[model samples]
Target: MSMFDNISVVKKANVYFDGKCVSHTVQFPDGTRKSVGVILPSTLTFNTGAPEIMEGVAGSCRVRLAGETEWKTYHAGESFDVPANSSFDIEVMGDPYHYVCHFG
Candidate 1:
């Protein structure tokens, strides 16, 4: 799971939050798509169109899902699910957080 084989990557970067977050689309042979990206040290909100599984690759982050009061921490090799049409707040400090977003 460290690398993806037989996949196509979109050349254009998906940049947001004044460049606080940047990612590129990775398409698989089966037509599923994912995003590989890094989130710089910042607090940000993201809205999702599709149900997603956020897999951490490096570093760590504190996440507060919509309507949640407690913030949870996720490190490398951890994953969190976000429901479709919902949003979450993520706070990254110190090192940049690297992740792969699986879309369903």
Candidate 2:
């Protein structure tokens, strides 16, 4: 079995992307903590199921799914998710961003 196989409670962690910040908590199954930050220039896209990716918005950026119609704006204190089997991308409208991610 895994080291965390017996874990039951959820663990929380904080991540900062660009200027945006978010807290993630994972429970049961795999007692892991994930934190992430992301910045995009123009537009960037990724395939789904690649992994669980989180991006924190710093300045001005837009996030949306590939071939989708709408783009959501992300700013400081905002968080976005990259779901499994879903395509997503981010467009940077300002400067380069930074994200602090921790996973265990």
Candidate 3:
């Protein structure tokens, strides 16, 4: 039950947020899709239709979960969970934020 046991990569993706972010969609053997992206320095809010695990692969950012008053910072090898049908804010403080979003 290890991660990356049967993965497929789709190398190219459309630039999102007017070029502030770019992501490649990848798939797992179980048919789950993940978006691996690099986000430029900016504050952005995203809505999740399903539960998601956002993993930080490089750089850092501060995130405020929906209905939360405090902001948490995540760096390389860190991850956070976002609830389904909720929104969260991410602030990139002058560095690109690289992440992989796994949906469930």
Candidate 4:
């Protein structure tokens, strides 16, 4: 799916880590929500309230989920799952990492 259809988007952006990460909430007609965002070149940790699937849209990133030791790389068209109430470390270098976050 190259684009989303019949969705409502929040006008304000969700800024984090001093704006290194930014996203906007997109709500679907079925009441599901997702976020489309880009992470600037940096290494950051994010805590999740709900379980999420991080789908890579552009560029690439190295991620280490909570309790993990090894780092795995995800490029465009790849995805990674994060558990609820958990955290993950993401490292994005050179180009910004674009992603769509599917929340549950």
Candidate 5:
């Protein structure tokens, strides 16, 4: 099926981090959930329980995956992967970091 062909059912999550992040949580028929949100300029670390794909939807940001010292940049339409049971650092640039996180 094409994208958005059967996307009429979706759920909204409460404003998180005092509105710094907001997103729509979508659950497909196969039981996968994806969170799409925008992250304000901030430095944060995240741990993943399941494998995730974080895609940049608007602004850009820098990320340092676990076991790496160098930071890589990801711009709009780009994406990065976080392995299950691992952590990563996120450095938001000058603008909001709009993203869609796909979980499996």
Candidate 6:
């Protein structure tokens, strides 16, 4: 099979919340395979056993791990990884918060 054969374009979503706009593009591969997600200027909390990479392009935000009361800050040109099975929350803290997320 071609490298991208098993990949299917799932859907695209745009969301607006708390005066911020986010765009999401989801892609799914074959059986039990990991999916890819692209997000723009969005805060997310993961509830499954998937690893993710979040990158900041502009503005800033904070990430709070599950069961933790502290937040780790991220700014423009910064990136962080979310371990498998971990729960985390993010919030945009500065103007024109822009970020990208890739999950699998």
Q: Evaluate model 1: give its lDDT.
A: 0.98
Model 1 Cα lDDT, one tens digit per residue, 1-98: 78988999999999999999999999999899999999999999999999999999999999999999999999999999999999999999999999
Worst 10 residues of 5 by lDDT: 1-10
lDDT by residue (tens digit), candidate 4, 1-104? 88999999999999999999999999999999999999999999999999999999999999999999999999999999999999999999999999999999
Give the higher-TM-score candidate: 1 or 5.
Answer: 1
The alpha-carbon lDDT assigned to residue 43 of candidate 2 equals 61
Model 6 lDDT tens row, 8-79: 454655554543555544444544333322233567665537787777766787888788899999886788
Better of 4 and 6 by TM-score: 4
Q: Tell me which of candidates 3 and 6 scores higher on TM-score.
A: 3
Per-residue lDDT, model 4, residue 80, is 100
> Model 2 over residues 8-52: C-alpha lDDT tens digits?
433544443443434444344554644344444556665655445
Candidate 6: the clashing residue pairs are none
Clashes of each: 0, 5, 0, 0, 0, 0
Candidate 4 regions with alpha-carbon error over 4 angstroms = none
TM values, all candidates:
0.98, 0.50, 0.87, 0.98, 0.83, 0.57
lDDT of model 5 at residue 25?
A: 77
For every candidate, C-alpha RMSD to the true structure in Å: 0.6, 9.2, 2.6, 0.5, 2.6, 5.9
Looking at model 1, residue 11 earns an lDDT score of 100
Q: Against the unseen true structure, what C-alpha lDDT does each candidate score?
A: 0.98, 0.53, 0.88, 0.98, 0.82, 0.62
Q: How many clashes (backbone atoms < 3 Å, residues ≥3 apart in a chain or on different chains) does model 1 have?
A: 0
For residue 20, model 2's alpha carbon misses the true position, in angstroms, by 18
Top lDDT: which candidate number?
A: 4
lDDT string for model 3 (1-104, tens) is 11455689887795877888788888988788898888999988888899999999889999999999999999979999999999999999877998988899
